[model samples]
Target: MPKFAANLSMMFNEVPFPQRFAAAAAAGFKGVEFLFPYDHTPAEVAGWLRENQLENALFNMPPGDWAAGERGIAALPGREEEFRAGVARAIEYAQALGTKRLHMMAGLVPAGADADSYRATYLANLRFAARECGLHGISVLLEPINGRDMPGYFLQTQAQAHALREECGEPNVKVQMDFYHAQIMEGDLAMKFKRWFSDIGHVQIASVPARNEPDDGEVNYPYLFRLLDEQGYDGWIGCEYRPRGRTEDGLAWLAAYNQ
Candidate 1:
């Protein structure tokens, strides 16, 4: 069976951030993931995971100036120093949380920006992150967010991500495949998963167009779940979707899957 991890950032909003650990555990989740855990100290976050007996599935490295509309700095020129500092801080949290996967967001592209410059910076930054993370036995991840949801985002396609990964030539650097974005940008979900199975570090799901529970998605998650089991994907499948109602109440699909 494929292991599922609750995305604390999106799910279990009825409770406080710290309390969501227990909420996820009580809802039958053995692992959990979130966008960023920088709001709380590593010790505090680790304590909650220990208390709830939940494994930390994955989390993102700090995206630069989130409130000011910056998505990430990994691809932005002149932010190399800031990006490296973020990587170190992320490793600190990963060690405390016992997390093995870290997603690195490629920052948004400026209007009339030089693609070559951004690509060069992104590859260099990814190589740096891969080296830093490899020493600690952690894998760095690159995700392709659809343009519709995140306009001007530096990364936007699976092919592009894979090409960049190949160019970086780092074994520990892998792709974070979110099915929601995949379905939007590239509809051949099953084939794509199979094609890139070797380089995929993490998986996530949500309904296409609506970005809700996977139960009603355009893509058939049930079949995909079976495929993951058959393919022997021994990785956590992150539930990174917003609930239609109460997070727990909207988990009928999870209950059904477990049954």
Candidate 2:
């Protein structure tokens, strides 16, 4: 079975952030991932991880002022300085948390802008972040989120993510394969998963369309998990899904998979 990581940002909402680490541990998750760790001091989060005996599977680089509708700044024009600064800050936190992966969210393309301009800016920013992250033994990932979730958001397909990574010319840059996003944007999940398996560094899962628990929707996660095992994918699979009820109640699928 693929190793599993609890997504603290989306899961375990019944408890506070700090307490979620212990909650995940109690629920049998050996690793964890989250959105941003800016508010909590690195030392504080490190302490929690140590206490819970969980590996920091993954976390995203800052995406600018999230409250102001900025999904990410990497693809935004004239934000190179802010983007690089965010990369540096994320590195500091990653080092402290012993995390080896960071996802970079490509921001939305402005209404009047074209794909060429956004791609150029995104590639440059990814290269810079990839180099910085590479120095810390971390892989920089670019996730292709679906337009339904965030319309106009740059980078919305596996092919586009691969193209950007190649254009970035940074060996450390890789793809964060979120199955839920892929299912939303395209069908034939298993075929695409196999096709792009090599380029993927980290993985996330949720149900299709609704983004709920994996088993509740169209995606057949068990077969995919078996395929991953057959292929020897030794990375963390983040349970990046929302619960239909209590978070703990939704973990039956995890137990079934482990068996």
- The lDDT of each candidate is 0.95, 0.90
Pairs that clash in candidate 2: none
Q: Where does candidate 1 clash, by residue pair?
A: none
Q: How close is candidate 2 to the true structure, as a TM-score?
A: 0.98
lDDT of 1 by residue, 138-247 (tens): 99999999999999999988999999999999999999899999899888999999999999999999998899999895889999999988888999999999999999
Off by over 4 Å in 2: none
lDDT for position 212 in model 2: 86
Expressed as tens digits, the lDDT of each residue in 193-252 for candidate 2 is: 788888899989999878888887788889899989988899999999999889999888
Question: Best by lDDT, which number?
Answer: 1
Which structure among the candidates has the greatest TM-score?
1
TM-score versus the correct structure, for each prediction: 0.99, 0.98
